[model samples]
Target: MRDPILEGALRRVRDEKARDRGRRGRLRAATSAALAAAVLAGGLHLGRHSLPAHRILVATTGSTRMTTTITPADGWVRLHAAVDGIDPGERCTLVVTDSHGRRYVAGGWVAARREHTDLDGAALVDPADLATISVVTVDGRTLVTTTA
Candidate 1:
């Protein structure tokens, strides 16, 4: 014969254990869903940047070399350039020209003791309307030019 009080206590403990198991199962499902979502998002992010884009060789010199990789996104062309042989504390400007002969300029100063500089500048001109992009010195000497 079973003791009535002990039987009730054991039944209560079993019910509590069942509830804890259910909670643990739900937590695992939630964690798995979150991890899958994160992986998918990461893949999409990499896919956007991994696609082939236009790489235009802008300039090649013994002392300095530059190249522009133009990636089309939305309605505009994104410009990225790697520049070298720039003197420290020198002022440099980026110029972009449209087919209509309008020029856009982005200017910045180089760092001290830095011999190489990487420039990133964008133009509002559409990829179709872009004529040329160039990096020029303050005295108007062209350093790098990419024609579209």
Candidate 2:
């Protein structure tokens, strides 16, 4: 049990890596400074207007919540469920309607979501229903939508 030579070499390699990481901080700081200088020199021109991306909270069965980063809110809100717990003949629907009388229908999405829960799929709400992100129940059924 004598490997002093190999152990020394491994220690040297690890020490070098740590030292290099410490030195990299200076390089990163310089890079950020250069970027700031360029933006100041170029005046950072931007368009007259930009589209505002919608922000919505997604809640699904089995979890309190998760969120998607600021992205193109150009589709429907989706819900997901577990396959093992779903009944073969039972059906569910997702209906999203905006405050302006626009409606988005996502009937029979529960089956697909149950099938793909392992893949973390979402049943998207219609883009038109982007105006509401809350829940409204009717006739013993709960509806999901966007809200203020």
Each model's lDDT comes to 0.75, 0.44
Q: The CA-based lDDT of model 2 is what?
A: 0.44
The positional error of residue 129 in candidate 2, measured at the CA in angstroms, is 6.9
Model 2: how far residue 81 lies from native, Å: 10
Residues 1-148, model 1: lDDT tens digits: 9799999999999999999999999999999999999999999998875535675766765566667777765556677777777667666787878999998774454535446677777777777777887777778877667677
TM-score of each: 0.55, 0.31
lDDT of 2 at 92: 45
Please name the candidate that would achieve the greatest TM-score relative to the true structure.
1
